[model samples]
Target chain A: MSRRFASLGLALALVCGLAPARESAAADTYAVDAVHSAVVFRIKHMNTSHSWGRFNELTGTFALDEASPSQSHFEFQVKTGSVDTGNAKRDQHIKGPDFFNATQFPTISFKSTSVAKGADGYDVTGELTLHGVTKPITVKIVPVGVGKGPTGGSIAGIDTSFTLKRSDFGMNKMVGPVGDDVWVNVSIEGGKK
Target chain B: MSPAGMMLATLVLPFVSAGLVMIGAGWLGRRLGIERADHAAAALAVGVGYVVGHAAIASPTFPPLDVTDRIPWLAGLAAILGILESIWPGPSWTLWENRLLLTALVLSALLGPLFAESSENRPSTVCLVVYGLIALASWTNLSGLADRLSGARLGVPLLTVGFGIAIALVVSGSLALGQLSAVLAAAVAAMVLLKLGSPMLLGTVPVMVATFGALLLNSFIYAALPASAAVALVSAPAAFWVSRLGRMERLATWKVVLVTEFATLIPVGIALALAFSASPGYAE
Candidate 1:
């Protein structure tokens, strides 16, 4: 009877010790607030003016630990096939191999590597993969206004931007007239993962 | 001076240099018994086609008024290729020659319809120039094959890999037309240096031509825009002289030229894109 009681106590203690990890994981859940979040980009159309584009369906999760923010991580997956450039014909062309090669590479994604606090915001370094090519990029994420949702959910807002070279991953089809530097603007709204 | 003079300086000189080189290549090919001078001449002609295509429809002012010029540079390149074939028996180079003709034809077919779509003209013609230049690079590769001349001395595999890297940049929107060309020129020039045992004098020209050519072209496009007029004016001389120094330097100048131009243009591309995207009136 004593042995059974002691075993039960040990199991309970182990569970208690691991409780923090489980709870932290649960606390890290994040829901992208669609109304407040966006993924945007700008590229040179000719050498003249910038062409702008955005992806509408941005679905992601953010896992964070308040005590150890370095343990925080994010997973963002955007539908490459969902690119919007305000023109249907051009969108089709862009989705082709010359640009996104969406059929061949359907998802645009980012997985967080490290995060550091800065004066104005935080620098988030991650591996961003687009069109089957992946590269390491650092995005300076400026904390936009953060607040509570009407539903009493904790919401954190972040605005970040990064510059990437398209050729690093293999999308070197368009040049001469079209500017190459693809600038990405990300507005993220996260809740506990 | 006439508006033409400014345009000629900004847009015409590269073509002239390209043409002069074609003439020299033809003479040299014959002198050195280097097989096919015609192919080199044809390549030069395509270079002229690129300049003329870019310069054709502008106001000849400091900033030529538009962003997208669709002046049929491909047609000129095609015509020259056609002429070259007739002058020289090209069956020896069928594989590459055919691919060149086919690609030009395809581009023309794809873009040809747009010519008649509207005469309203895009404010900046950078996109079209980019497409044309990519085609030019394709042509260069094709011509290189036809003449049995490996211009960069990099094996076909490395060249393919470099092109693949470039394509990734294009798709990801990290390196646009200008940056792509600059990088490619740099890569090609570096290859020449490496292959030639880093010969200081002979190796410098291609690097100068490729790097400065890209920067000058980009700066000229920027200058042609009235909105970017100030920035272009300040940077144009810098582009010109940097290129001039690249040209005049006898050392293996590829590293300096390529790195400087690339570093300078990359940030410019990011800033220009962000600035334009942030503007209110522009359509996103």
Candidate 2:
């Protein structure tokens, strides 16, 4: 009976010790709230107007280090196959070899190499891989808003917009009517640990 | 690029290059005294035509990044294999041995791109096994594809299948793959047109099989080609055996050609019909 009590005490101590470490890790790195995030883009269509589309699936995490801001980093991965351009037929075409070839190169990912706080937002320089091509690109991430959840965790809202040429990523198809330049907007909400 | 430019690159250029090389092959063979020039000619024609079209379409990215990019290189390799298969005066068993080894290479070349980099994008192991088997069937001579050709028995069928697959891929949603299919088809067409007179020592069977296998598998796996349509297209290679029947052998040359093309067309027709019928849902 005494030995059983001792084992219980040790197990409780181990659980209590692991909790803080787990929470600290969680506090530093926040998993992206995919439901609250949007990756939308628009390209010039028929040399007339902008045609918009978005990816429906996203995942990744971001680390925040307030004491050492330079230590902060972001990693985002978007499923190229989840593109939703409203029209299913066009989406199928875009997903094929003419453009994304999503089956072979499924994810377009970004991992920040450097991050610096700017006047408007955070200037993040990272390697953005799209369509099996990787390139270093910079984007300014501005704080959109913040809120407190019912569970008392803080929520962060981030908004960023950038323009990229599809040709840069080796997506050299339908250039004129589809436009070389594609404007992208990312709005994301993350829960702090 | 403009429609005219795409047409010129994917269609006209391939036709012109293939025609020039084939016409030149006969003259060059006589001068060089290379007995197997027909095989080399056929392989070179497809290789040159595909590379030219690929360069125009994808713009020659060195160390090819995607499966589509790797096809041009595969075409070159398949051409070499075709020439070697024709010229190498090895025993029948030795031919089978070489083909067994080549089958693995061909399988890896086609399926490697899909399985190389990403885990999430991978097909199930069962699917991989099935595709590998399908590839083996298409790549090897087990289906009675002769190592050396005496006639255009294979070419006529191949031409029908090639055009069928091209149109099928186009209707299925991927114009890029369709155009690439057309590039291969045009090259095959030129070879068949030039070699019509003498079926003597034609060497393009292996490369034709390799290319059609690649295009059929690639379009179905990556593009919007449906399973039913793919099944019909896969039947194309075996359809040529119909021409080798006892009845077909006794017919006149022109009658044999007509009969061979018709036999091949059944599968091609089903494939095309399937693609067209399903287009409203996919290409709308």
Candidate 3:
């Protein structure tokens, strides 16, 4: 009778949105620590060496679970005008109409729609909006590690790198000289709530 | 094309159109016996140069997603409207009315986007509206100068102002805006090459004026251009009135021109100086 009663309660708990004690109940929410995280990009200059740049301002949040990859999600918003390339003149030109067009399209954003476990880590499919154009992009994100934060909160490190065609986003200017392929590298440190 | 290539094209294409198309159309109009076709040709040449020059830098997107993408298409519209205004046999008031409507449309296209977005960095709506009114008034007076003054008298001031504004924008941290401004000046130079000291105005006046207002507004709102510098730049062309001194009977044309050039340089100098001092690009 005791074993039968335990099974009935277990069934009720499952129906009431409770998970088994051994399994994760929900994904942990992590607010991106902008100070420690960074998004950087490099494009070939004249098809020779790479030219590097980074967005100075970024804000985002993510929910992640290794056990339940389906529940994992990431979203990021980057201020387009904050593009810093070290050279002031080229920075202005890049921010102008020919490139990002920062005034009209002030923000570049990404919101993940799906996440799936891959061989290395998780393959996240999301919409990346850039230069006033939005397109679906899939990126491979690896779980670097996890530790305690300065405030004694849980923390996680994720790393990702992807290549995208500039022409695909309607940025076709100087295609030959500036090259079409841009490689983006992101290292994110998120603090768990 | 590379940036250097784009800059070269910006300066050269307009000169080519103005030099070749303007004279060719005027001569052909006389040969084919089409009246006022020369006036229409002037507008067409400048518009063609402007659109082509801008496209050479950045090909516009389909449906124009970005504000700058509309530049080539807007230049096309201004050319068409200018040709109609030039050829219309309607009353003077009707021509002015058509021009007024065109001004409103152009202002909305350029300034409307800036005003729609609520951002602290952007100029206030009232200031932008007043700036548009100032640009409109500036164009009207410059067009009047086109009727009384022609040749270097008209072209030099425009060229100087264009180069000045271009320099100011570049210093204020927008190479693209500076290049765009220089492109307009190049088109005007082309028109002046064809019709020096002729005492007539063409549709190019409205075309240049409309585009100039839009570019200046973008420079201030989008780039690091300061508001005070924009005002001084907008009012820079008004100094063309000083060229009226050439109309004096006893004044040597060279003496009158020298003084006119210096007078036109004042506002541009002030604007450039202000841009250098106040621009966030420089301050940072």
Candidate 4:
């Protein structure tokens, strides 16, 4: 009877250990590919047309827990001075104190707090810090594809979009000419780290 | 509210609130036997009014405990100090104590904009030092001018005009900054009215605090105008000495007032013109 109990305890311990290994196998870490990833934003201009811009620099990492999506995490930072609206003069003005105040607040960042699997993909709730203010925001993320890369590494594609008010981040300048509601779209190709 | 309505409210609320507070404080002072209550009241009014005005126009996400929010509280503290000085009138504040107070005020103002950002993006040490020097010099010169012109009834009005032009210039560049500038202008206007009733409050600590605080706001937070233009505006009051030219002191009070306003306007007008020419095409 003693021998049977000891064997049972060992088997239970092995099962528990194997379960985490299996879960972690599905949890892959990825480094954002700056060359393929893009963050773009658009806002209404003068109530007639939309003005579009993009950030040239971005750096972040993500952990995708496929089995348990609740354990997934993501964080990203974008250089505010890298804002490019296709107009050099306009870009400089935007970087000035009137808008981003890049010298004072150089980076706009987001860090996920909780992620949950949704019907289509996932809903990620996080704190976005922009223009020196931090606010809770939720992003709807859709998985684009997962495939093997040319470098023999696994790559995952994701698309995310969210809408935020510029004034909420204290970027209230030129609200009449430049719309307050800004829509952001991000397309990322992350490779296994 | 419409965007236009929001902007209007942002500008008007602070002006009205500061004016009311100043007037109310004056009435209360007379009843309470406090001779310098007008100055303290003006400072407190401006501080409170600014917070309210900012909140009215600010986004719902604005943090309640931000470093920028401390401006009003600091101004309030300065007002309290002014009241204490009025009540005690005992031993004079030591030179070190005075210097320390001035340093603290200037540093606090500078930190407002810097601390608004996350730690990784904070300004460099070199930038901070440069800002500190400029702020210190501007505050010292302006306060000195205020001391010299304290006895002159026109002094406060001249300062008010300076602030008004700053608002117009800032508004032309950034609406949010313009709102802040408008609040400062209103606060100064209220203080001017208080000074008219109680001339003794004109050059008190509270008045200096309000003046320096407004200048800091223009220079640091709403840096839409060029640095040179801002410096010129702050230093315009230093030109008050020109009004004290030979034989001008003996002139009638009305003539002195006219000369002082005119002299102060010369630099201020030039500064405004520079600001307009340098401003980036009116917030486009």
Candidate 5:
């Protein structure tokens, strides 16, 4: 009877010791601050000139799962109406149904599916939902660093990039000869959750 | 074009088509007249078409060839060369020599349509094709120069131990080999395709043949079996082989170009097929 009790106590101690390690494996989550991140694209103008532009007003949540990336999740909402170029007329035209159709599909989103660590970074695979279509996208992410924020909070910074076919998500209409690819640049800052 | 597409266009199709045309163009070129133009016109037309096509594939405009101006004239000039290669059997160049030159020209032409940035699909696809052609071209030149420098030294082995390691890894099922093997094969082919100064078809044939043979061998290894292996399998050996071949080649101007007319024909055919297939109302 004494040996049984002692064995049970030792098992309990082992379980208690492992709890913190498992907890540490959980990656922190962060809320993306739109003002800090930039979403931009470039297209060839008339097969001669290259033109660039950006979209403003984005709100999103980034969940980092250090333990199991498959368990991680990312949800982002970009206001379709925020499409902007230096030219107001072009911006307006882009927002119309022929382009972004902001009124029709009001949000562009991404959700994480998996993450695999690599030599200097990690490969993050996810589904990017845009223009009412969802497609698998993978991006290579390098952790810039992690530290405390001005608000007495912890934060993590990461940079990632991937390419998507605009036409795949039904963004086929164009004002001119703009090609179908739209490259995405992701700069994310996550806070401990 | 997305990066994925660029991967396909620049890295994949160029080598595939180059291999295919190299194998078949002798009879086809006879029908098409691929060798007739004076060397200068032939070179300029092929070079310009190749460069322009490359520029278009890389840019975002999806630029269509200029229908009204210089493009047609260039096309006509290229067409004349095409006719010469196909029908004219009267030249000093043997069947093997003709085949080699045609393959190189086709690859060069195709490179124009395939070169693109890695992130965009259209460009990536084009880039993959260009990469494949370049790989084949690189190998051809490497071997040609090596042979000339050695005066037909037969002891050099183009396939290194790395090839066996890759084959073993691939067969054992560790990494994805399809796309990677294709790319590695191109690399091997490129190492041999390095040029010598002479324009003589006979001078270029051996290197082109050996480079292309290596690419085919790599492709055959993968196509014959659906295996999982990291790209390093083929790439590691290709790197080793390229170094060995380069070391053997004597000092000479590296101006050798693997770009050619047949290269244009294949991608244009593929692109046209894609465009037609993607036409409105076509099933996804």
Candidate 6:
């Protein structure tokens, strides 16, 4: 009975000793709040006007290490079929092969390769896979702030904007009339997970 | 320019180039020291050049490698095969060599689309087997037709035109596909002019490669039209066999052309109707 008590005490001590170490190594993880977050893009239309479109479905997670920002990681996926440009006909057309070929590719995704501190916020370099093509892209992520949510959960807000040429992702169908460069803006609200 | 204007220009560029090449085929053929300038080769080169140039101009930065891009690469492979066939001539090729080449070209064209489709849902092995069989059968049928009508001055050109028109109609649902269809039409139009007088056999290899490549792109990559519709359009050339009917035995050349066109139009019309019906309002 004494030996059993001593073993139990040693196990308890070991657990207590590892808790702080684990806490120190753990980075805060946030689950993207889809209801609040949005991925939107704008492209030139007929070289005359800018047409705005947005993806309805977005899911991602990010690990933030405030002490060492470079250790932060980010991942995101946008459903190509969920593209909405207001007009249903146009949305369907974009979902077709002429633009997205969503059936074949399904989704456009990004996975961060590296993160670095920047003057404004953070420069996150990642591989963006779109239209079945994967290319390394960097986006400037500006942290909005971290605060307590109405639900008493920790919430973090981030804003990122980047310009990507559609042709870079093999969407080289209409060029002159519809401009090639596409401006993407991401506003994300993440809850602590 | 407007989108329509851009599309028209893209479509016309290949036709103009083909016409120029056709007009100069004799001189080019003589200059190259070949029996003929090889109209099919010219078509392949011009078609591929236009596609590449269009891609380059549209997006100076080429897209990263992907399965859909294989269509252009396969077209390039077909062009290389066409050049070799022109230089070496098909009669000298061994039976096994022909078979191997045919298999390679067909497989390359089919695999890319198959892989693309497989990603949508898990395609069973049975489906793949059926697909492979269909591809082989289509390749055999089209290649045989091309071989039989090779030396016929008007037959191949008429069939090519029918194919181009059919593909254009089928792909009209999608602007990108329509552009590709236009490129194909321009290539064949050029081939028709180039091979007008000399009439060297346009080898079956390029036809199989380009036709199958385009069909795969239409069915798998873009899926703008139903697969059955694309099949009907591509296989419409088999209607060339209609010329072998008893009524066509003693018919005049113009009558033959008219009859063949009529027969080919049946399938082409059906394909067009199906494609347009599939897309309620695909107007760009």
Highest lDDT, which number?
3
Off by over 4 Å in 3: A1-14, A17-23, A44-49, A87-93, A172-180, B1-7, B27-34, B115-123, B246-252, B278-284
Docking tier of model 3: it is acceptable
The regions of model 2 sitting more than 4 angstroms off are: A1-29, A63-68, A150-152, A174-177, B116-118, B121-133, B139-154, B250-252, B276-284
Per-residue C-alpha lDDT of model 6 across residues A46-65, encoded as one tens digit per residue: 77899999998999998767
Candidate 4: the clashing residue pairs are none
In the range A33-63, model 5's lDDT, one tens digit per residue, is 6776777777766566777777787777776
Report the Cα lDDT for candidate 1: 0.49
TM-score of each: 0.41, 0.86, 0.88, 0.76, 0.39, 0.79
Give the alpha carbon lDDT tens digit for every residue of B83-103 in model 5.
Answer: 443335446445446445544
Residue-pair clashes per prediction, in order, are 49, 0, 2, 0, 80, 0
Per-residue lDDT of candidate 4, residues B19-85 (tens digit): 8877887689778988766655655666666666655654323342333344445555555665555
TM-score for chain B in model 6: 0.74
> lDDT tens string, model 4, A1-193?
9999999999999999899988667778788898999999999988899989999999898877777898889899999889998876567567765578675678899999999998888899999999878899999889898899999999998899889998887776557777999999999889988
The pairs that clash in candidate 6 are: none
Scoring model 1 with DockQ, what do you get?
Answer: 0.02
Give the per-residue lDDT digits (tens) of candidate 2, residues A105-125: 899999999888888878889
- TM-score rank order: 3, 2, 6, 4, 1, 5
- Sliding window of 10 residues with minimal summed lDDT for model 5 chain A: A96-105
Q: How far does residue B25 in candidate 6 sit from its true spot (Å)?
A: 6.0
Cα lDDT tens digits for candidate 1, B52-109: 4233322122221111222223334443544454345456567355544545454443
> What is the overall TM-score of model 3 with all chains considered together?
0.88
Clashing pairs in 3: B151-B196, B151-B197
